[model samples]
Target: MALARGFADPVHDAQAVFRTVMDALARPGLVRRLACGLAPPAPLTPELAALALTLADADTPIWLDPSLAGCAAVSAFLRFHAGAPIVANPAEAAFALIADPGACPPFAAFAQGTPAYPDTSATLILALARLSEGRGLGFAGPGIRGRAQLDAAPLPPDWPERLQANHAAFPRGVDLVLTAPGRVAGLPRSAQALVPEEA
Candidate 1:
């Protein structure tokens, strides 16, 4: 049902979502779950859809990959809820939400900001099965000092390679927000990831 019985639920949910987002960004390497339940359609999972609702608006430009089966459904929902502009290509997007990362465009194809204002790069929000945990690639950098693992299953073979290239761009590469069933993690501009050595 609708959450707004009064001022309390909406206020609380908003605070919770905001807190989750803040935690994701603040920690940088860990995934924090958002409270999700707003179903849009197939392929565009509830958690991802909730994020779109929480973070987007008319000012944001979003790009949707063709892999998401509910493009029309998601587009209509976004138009109704966020009023955000939906672009046809990834390069044109400020936020490109991808349900299937394997088919996603190469990192070089997206906008890597010019030297003057390298921070103008795009943010890619990818829908994942889990954030990251032990036995996976270890990450370290700005927010992380030592190392930590995540349960990032079923990504493209070259995802880490792509990220490495993106990282090399210094201040110009795309940032990432990986969301799963209820959790998400934000990988910002300053972090670096180290893949585990295979024994």
Candidate 2:
């Protein structure tokens, strides 16, 4: 099978994507558009491919969830374009691509970094079925002014509880970037999920 092409302008496109990623993280629970110019293989979405191209490198090891790992084309595409090492161990990865959000592992399953070097934690890039509409979850913390809401699904039903614990871990936790088609959103470790009664 023929592989899809990467960004038309690597320098500019990557910069745009980087900004989008940053903005999403900066404004937790806010959605942003990723005008990624790639059409990667099945299971590997444009947003995920764009992220892999923009963030992954030779030094960064990436872990793909079973859904994505089983796709040979997705592996080949990332290997060819990102030139990043694919690791079998999630704890050893600097980044992880999750194509099946419902089946994705808990935050504790991946690297949660150390108190001294919290930046070493793994970042999960989750592909969601609908980021624009779902059962809304409220968030509050650092990046958010008061509180913010997001509706990305089908995430694990325990996500709110999981995220709360992830936040309580403070400087040692995993961050999440959610994507759907051309849309992207962030749920950084600093963002704390609110219970329904509070939302």
Off by over 4 Å in 1: 1-15, 196-199
The per-model lDDT (C-alpha) reads: 0.72, 0.91
Candidate 2, clashing residue pairs? none
Q: For model 1, what is the C-alpha lDDT against the true structure?
A: 0.72
Candidate 2 lDDT over residue span 1-199, tens digit each? 8887988999999999999999998988889988897889988989999999999999999999998999989998999899999999999999999999998898898999999999999999998889963348888898888778888888988888999999999899999999998999998999998876644
Candidate 1, residues 1-199, lDDT tens digits: the string is 2221211254566567767876786677786767665666667777666667667778877888887634576777666665689888677777788898667778776667777888567888788866755656666777775875566856788877776777777888888888888888877766667765579
List candidate 2 stretches off by more than 4 Å.
Answer: 133-135, 197-199
Clash counts for all predictions: 5, 0
Models 1 onward score TM values of: 0.86, 0.95
Compared with the true structure, model 1 gives a TM-score of 0.86
